[model samples]
Target: MPLRLPPLPALRFFEAAGRHQSFKLAAAELNVTPSAVSHGIVGLEEALGVELFVREPRGISLTATGADYLSYVSEAFSLIAIGTQRLPNHRANRPIALSCAPTFASRWLLPRLPLFRARWPKVNVTVDTSHRQVGFPVDGFDFAIRLSRAPVAGSAWTRLFGEQLVPVCSPGYLESLRDVQGTPLLSNATLIHVNAASEDWQTWLEATGAEHVDPDAGLRVDTIQLAFEAASMGLGVALGRRPLVNRDLESGALVQAAFNTVNSATAYWLVSAENADRRPELLDFRQWILAEAAQFSCDTSVDAAAAQ
Candidate 1:
């Protein structure tokens, strides 16, 4: 008069099949044959005394009971994942929550995320994209990618990269902005501004001596990448940052209007809680990220040579 539970193997097989809706693909993932997967599912169904799947030659479909049971199994597997992640020598089995400005994530890191995943797939990444200043230790983030002109005060900070701002637009957009003296002017299109960096546009205006132009009068965006994207789409001219839009320039999505680049003291920095060093995952991640930075240096050298 007691209820019975399906074996782990059978439940796993069912979960795989339910996920892919194909016994053969599930078999491939599990390194078993389609027939073996089917047999396991059959055993599971018999044990539960219910039909779990709608069998067909093309593929399998989950029945009502199968769907309901699959949800429970999926949750159980998730807990197992969390448990196994807690094992020693691993980054905390908990998700590695990261915070960064949306612009930085989209323009720079998102493009290179595949490399990060390939190197550390087990480290669960949860990104918080906000433009506001987040208190690093109080906000519960493993690391913070901050866009600032000054170093984060009262925190352990490391400079990730330096930034240089240049005037850029699409090739066609630049052509339109070109004058009789071949000076690329900002008379055409809307000047995109990252409202967060009020000094950026003013600095460019001062360096170029475009006194007649209003630095604040244009489309305002909160992030540098948005400015780049607007320029790319011919929305207007933008002050492109070297580290953020270098790849975009190389890819022809954007074109530098002039070689005049001003060094901006502000740059992205990596910061973490004071106690972050105590965790193995945090330490491993820091080392891995630093290694990635080294690789970028080598790659840039190779690219420079290839450009010649």
Candidate 2:
């Protein structure tokens, strides 16, 4: 009598597929075809005598049985990862892979990365900038930086900084929105929208009680970085998110179109697997980032006080 189990490869496919919820994305991660991932999942389901995924026209979702199995499978993989890393030949031998959002990566992380490198010359850092909410061990990332109002899903999270939404444009562009009296003219400016159903312009307007600019009318884009870039080119006034926009504002490449700063519920957070803190490099990175966040918070407070 032997303990029956599915093929290891099929199990891997199931785990990745469940984590990604898309066979195509799982295939890309595993360097295989989507059909292969789909087939492997089918085979896995057959072996377990239970349907793992509820396949729908738009996408697939886990059944109750599938979700339960996924938890067990994911935990097992995490345990295996911990065990393998503790091996004498494998310990501290891999690059610290970080999955971070592209906008945050460019605007905040990359700029401060040099200091981390300077502090820890031996630590190898690999950054994945794809705009996807990745899983922990399954996704092969040690840490992530997420921007959300709610707690970071699927991982432990530490608050980084809250956002201040301020309308901004280039210094030269600011002069164009005046009636020769240097009086503010919000309607005269185009609103560069980095809209993700968030309707940032509308949020800012409602928060500040400003009525001149039409939130619906603007140059629409998808990312905060792009909107600011367009604004820097003297195109229009973009809603600048603080911390992300702090660098550009400091550089004088962008100026506040209005003096109002609307506080947002969302904040940047450092997210990680439950066991990720065991790694020395990860611990060091966490410490450095926390310190940076604290300093930024202090600076923001000082700026606010000065404005008042």
Candidate 3:
């Protein structure tokens, strides 16, 4: 007696399509035409006696059944890759591919990456910074760092840190203010805005009871890094995430315009595929990052206590 299995080619095509949510992109990846990918999926559906995808005007989406099947297939593929990499003759040269938010990457992670490299000399790391949501194994990422109210679906998530928004500006900018302690100061001062973040001047102003400030009046930038840069250059006051701006504050490049810091609902989350824990390198990175985050939290608590 022999065990039955899905056709390898069909399985490969289906996995790629399900991962990308598009037959066209899957076809490009598999080096086949879209029609071929479609045909392969049809053959797979017929063989399995189930439709895997729902066709749409904009793109294709996995059916409920397809999504379930993809999880198993993705796990199997990941395990196989892990096994292959662990072979005796194999070299440990593969870099851990991490997808992270642009602002977090530029402001926080990049500054600390050298520490990781110093600790794990043999391990390599590659980072891709984007605001787009990652699709796990299909996207070929080992891990991702996301800023969300909660964990993302279909992957393990570890809460890295909560965000505290504070109004920050260059020392020169603060010195130039006519009345730093005046209620009219916020209303009169120029504001710098990070377009994607929800913790804007309006939220900060409302939290700090500084309703006189016009929330919408400011220069808007696409990333927090840009807003920080603008603020550092004395362009305007930007709402800074405490963890991201800690180093700048310490270096005197920026100063808090006020003592009003409000915690945001969203936090940084570390996300990875279902089988990520089974991989040694992923586990190492996870442990290391969590430890670093814990230390950062402790340091922040001490700083707050001292300030109080």
Backbone clashes in model 3, listed as residue pairs: none
Candidate 2 on 165-228: residue-level lDDT in tens?
Answer: 8999999989988988888688899889886735388888888888766778979987888898
- Candidate 1: the clashing residue pairs are none
**RMSD, one per candidate, in order:** 13.7, 2.2, 4.4
Query: Candidate 1 vs candidate 2: which has greater lDDT?
Result: 2
Stretch of 10 with least lDDT, candidate 2: 84-93
lDDT of 3 by residue, 1-308 (tens): 89798898999899889988889888877789999999999999999999999998999999999999998988787677666655775545578889987767877898888999998998999898744446655566778888889975667899988888988999888877647464326666899988878767878877778866788988999888899999999998999898999889999999998887787888888887655676688789989988888888888778777877
What is residue 19's positional error in candidate 1, in angstroms? Answer: 44
Flag regions of model 3 displaced more than 4 Å.
1-92, 180-184
What is the clash count for each candidate, in the order shown? 0, 0, 0
List runs of model 2 lying over 4 Å from the truth: 197-199
Query: CA lDDT, every prediction?
Result: 0.75, 0.85, 0.83
